[model samples]
Target: MSRLAGRRSAVDIVIGVVTHVTHHELFHDAARTLSGVDLEWVSYDHEDEIRDKVAEFLSTTRLDGFLAGPVPYTASQELLPPGLPVGVIRSSALDLTLALYRAQERGWGRTPVSIDTFPAEAVEAVATALDLDQDQIDCLPYAPSQSVDEIVAFHRDAFARFGERSYVISVRAAVRGQLSGQIPIMSGMPVPATIRTELHELALRIESDRASAQRFAAGVFLISDAPDEERARIALMNHLHNTPEFAGAWIENRGRRGVVVFAHKALFERITRNWVAVPALAEAAAALGARISAGFGVGVSARNCVLLAEQAAARAELAVEPCAYLFEDSGVVIGPMGPVGAALRYSYRSHGDDVERLAKYVGLSATTVSRLAALDQELQGRTLSPGELAGHLGITDQSGRRLIRTLDAGGLVSVEGTAQHHPKGRPTRLYRLRIAQALEAQPWSSPAATSSS
Candidate 1:
């Protein structure tokens, strides 16, 4: 929400758009015109500055989502807030076809020509669609690894092979700039339909967030047992009051051993998304030498939700860690939160044939398996310490160490080194997640369940 957010009479959502290239004004105008929903758009100029621009926008104004080019979207994924929605604009087939038509209109299609804009497959697809023969086209493919000089050389070679009066088709700014004056070049920009579709998806995500924000939930904690130390109790209360997750919460003491805390439903659901808070709370209680268990309930009203959460928390205390359980208004109980402990013997629903196979092979929950796959790509075969792993998983350090041990037991990680005290006394141990190797391993009919037992 910006200063101009609710000012628009018809617009229901506010979003930000970042255009890296100058021509993005066309996309911004087109998406704004074609999209049926009333939207207030904030424009940003640089793609490389996505993180700074987005953070500033988020702080100053409220937005449902952000739109950017594919390069900016991919580069900013890890930097942006994980919960925030981002949409990427890409060039469509129609755009490529139109550019080729422009070249044809210039009478360049009549002679054998060379084109260098997209990759080989894309070039081939466009050539086929335009009914241009392979013999008449020397399609120079663009590889991401190629340097600007390499691309320039490629275009120069194509120009030499096809002779004068031919044209070079390039989408890259560098390639086009270099080929200018030396050769005739045509630009291919993304079409409005493609941009509108991406924007529509962003609007849908904003709607989803709005819907989720409206759903009310509450957490009820019952500290069934605790040490008789008054200092410990006071410390726990102070820490709870200071926690951002429990901000604006109301906490009450029931005797010396029991307590009740209430917070917004949205806060609890946000924790659930990252699988972080419940485990962090467990670790916190352990550090404070207090025995605590909590439950969360989602409903239309706060009072009923608290009562349900109390009941769910009572049930959770029977477990070892006493991780929070979620109780829906419809009477559904979800979990002992955090990563599902390896000791639990609960049946899991398979995501699909492929996911089920991967989960089974890795001896982890479907969610964990999916995250591990994503981490594999992010790490690029490099190792990460427990602290780094915690940062990656959005969990506390203790919880991250526990997860690493669980992963180790599942044969999904290789310990690369022993813990060494840093010059500053901080400890470090190198460990690599062996997800790729796990995929290559023989499929086990029954992989060890995600537990030490």
Candidate 2:
């Protein structure tokens, strides 16, 4: 039933099966076009690969949630536990089961869909909307397990079928003022444009006889060359505002002249021109003051770009922005900025702690812990109850039927969701912990070491 979703799967993206295709194609598709990321179409078999595919998705892709078959709920217990939001597509048809299996095969973890029950009629609704063969959508449930190598194979195959080659320059914009926490694309991935010329030109004029990487590091000129910071600041801003992603922006005072700039930490070493992305952004910014220039820096990884961009933007503001007559000598750096990076960094750090805690308990590699931590943290939130606490701890509630059972079983803490009290009926019950809790291990009480799950 996921006709278009699978069709566009060659370009892997952060999405789930429950999302309606029309909306998915309109918005997310634009994001992929502007950002150059794509989803892939993975053809999966229902009976042979159902379980294996689901597990593979859990291990490899960032899953939103797993879809359960009409088979008994008891059989589906350990498949994806209650720690994460999950849905069960109620379908006895083998083909429909297969679509769920295919959709399940991508990420390490994802935001679970609230539609836990996908009845046959509901599946039919999707089938009608997607113009898919209802019979084929019937047979898609069942599987065993997939190897780690297979997961890698999935990425490789998808890339081989739809990979690009170029010196990549990425300009990231937060969507709807929110961080989606989508996986950064694989390294060595090519972007749609190049930046060597702009960067090379800036390097030639910086006066310092040092290497280009060092000379252009600051995106600034000597006081002797530009005189005062204000003149330099204004001159730089005029030019940077022309580049892509700065659309509808204006220069604002920091301590000095130019505006701030940030890009992938990698861009400090290479300047990639995104001529393709300029027009739309320019229009968006046209109504605003429309002046921006960046001070650039080089970092070994994207994380470093956050701090570097802040430092560079601050310097750029003081250095003076260019106007009317100049090439693309934008004074701004290409990287993520400060203030803009607060939330992203915090989430990354918190997620890191989750990995460390889980790593000690499971004895998995640091990489696996890191990957799984992302899934765990993204799937959890404000809800806190006895079962949730236990599930969050990844411990089994083996004690008894009571809430304390979570503690005895292995649950470290508990969490709960909204529930209504039963006046004269049986006790009201909400979702329970399907995951086990943390076992006694190292502690996370200080800066040197921390623990969380």
Query: Of the candidates shown, which would achieve the greatest lDDT relative to the real structure?
Result: 1
Tens digit of lDDT per residue, candidate 2, span 262-322?
4332233223231111122233234233444343434444334334545544443453332
User: Per-residue CA lDDT of candidate 1, range 112-212, in tens?
Assistant: 65665443544655666567777766765432234557667877887787788667776556567778887888875566776776677568757866676
Worst 10 residues of 1 by lDDT: 343-352
Please report the TM-score between candidate 1 and the true structure: 0.53
Quote the lDDT for 191 in model 1: 69
Candidate 1's displacement at residue 169, Å, is 2.6
After the best TM-score superposition of candidate 1, give how far the Cα of residue 309 lies from its true spot, in angstroms.
8.7
- lDDT of candidates 1 onward, in order: 0.59, 0.30
Structural RMSD, model 1: 16.1
